[model samples]
Target: MIDQDHKLGVKEANLVSRKLQLSGIQGQEAEALVAEIEQQFGVDRVAYDPDAGTLAFSYDATHCNLDLVESILSKRGAGFATNWWNRTKRSYYRYVDQNIKDNAGYEPHCCNKVPRK
Candidate 1:
């Protein structure tokens, strides 16, 4: 009778608890391990959607000031040429250095003057 709603089944939970008990871990220490495992696997920014059967993810592109994220969002926006969410097929798109420089259509807002690091 292993309950599966808690991510881990009852048998697995019992095994893990037994192992922790054998290791002399009690109270907060044992609880901390369980919490850590849950957090590690649980989706924060990246995950797979079971209903959609698609991979969902997010990225912060500040490192290179890349425009891939912006482009994707723009394409997904209303009145755009493409609707990424409605597509049934998986598609891959990437930003290249050349595309950033040559594409006049992809003008990003610039501050003109950069502050000292």
Candidate 2:
């Protein structure tokens, strides 16, 4: 299968999907937040489920991270679930996002590609 290019700043190889239980906001407010997030660079897509109270999104980790989204949530009076599982996932997401961002500029060279001296 071939991987096609996604939105701006979003590469298929770097795409990540995340779903988080949300709190403190819903209905039109949640939709508004989703719209705001969707407008950000590197964000492939965003959706908020009112019934499940969860926000699911796809983004390119190398160009965008969870921190940027979280700031918007905080400012808009939304928050993640306080359960242990969600907390753990949040921490892991942060770690992976930072890792991707840190390595985004790195170019790997194969040993076989080196020219003979």
Candidate 3:
């Protein structure tokens, strides 16, 4: 018999692990993206597997949302899953992104001015 309880409390949570369809993305590129998310986006963490072409990221909803994250990746010419839900998400993010840009005193997550160790 198949078990349905195994799927409990997954997407209902704040942290969602949506994988992007980054075709032929390399390890170095993935690492660089990770660094970008951490340094510029203020993402708490990111897990990218070049072989699988998947990236799992976690951010504080209070500070920033996934739409902003997508905006950054979109700027890098990265592609995302073509699923209906993801597609809808991308669209919504686009709207939020514009508002973020238009709003005054609204800094985009973090900055790159920090000195490297």
Note each model's CA RMSD in angstroms: 20.7, 2.4, 14.4
Over 1-117, each residue of candidate 1 has an lDDT whose tens digit, in order, gives 243443422222222110000122334443343333234332123332333333333222211221332333334331112344322121222333233334524546668968558
For every model shown, what is its TM-score relative to the native structure? 0.21, 0.87, 0.52
Global lDDT of model 1: 0.29
lDDT of 1 at 80: 15
The list of candidate 3 runs beyond 4 A from truth reads 1-21, 88-117
Compose the digit string of candidate 2's lDDT tens values, residues 17-68. Answer: 8999998996889878998999999999898888898899999998788989
Query: Which one is best on lDDT?
Result: 2
Which consecutive 10 residues in model 3 have the weakest lDDT in total? 1-10
Residue 117 error, candidate 1, Å = 24
User: On residues 1-117, what C-alpha lDDT tens digit does candidate 3 reach at each position?
Assistant: 122321322122233334455543566777777778766433556788776677777543435567666666776777576778667866775565445435634556557677557
Superposed Cα RMSD, model 1: 20.7
Best by TM-score: 2
Greater lDDT among 1 and 2 belongs to 2
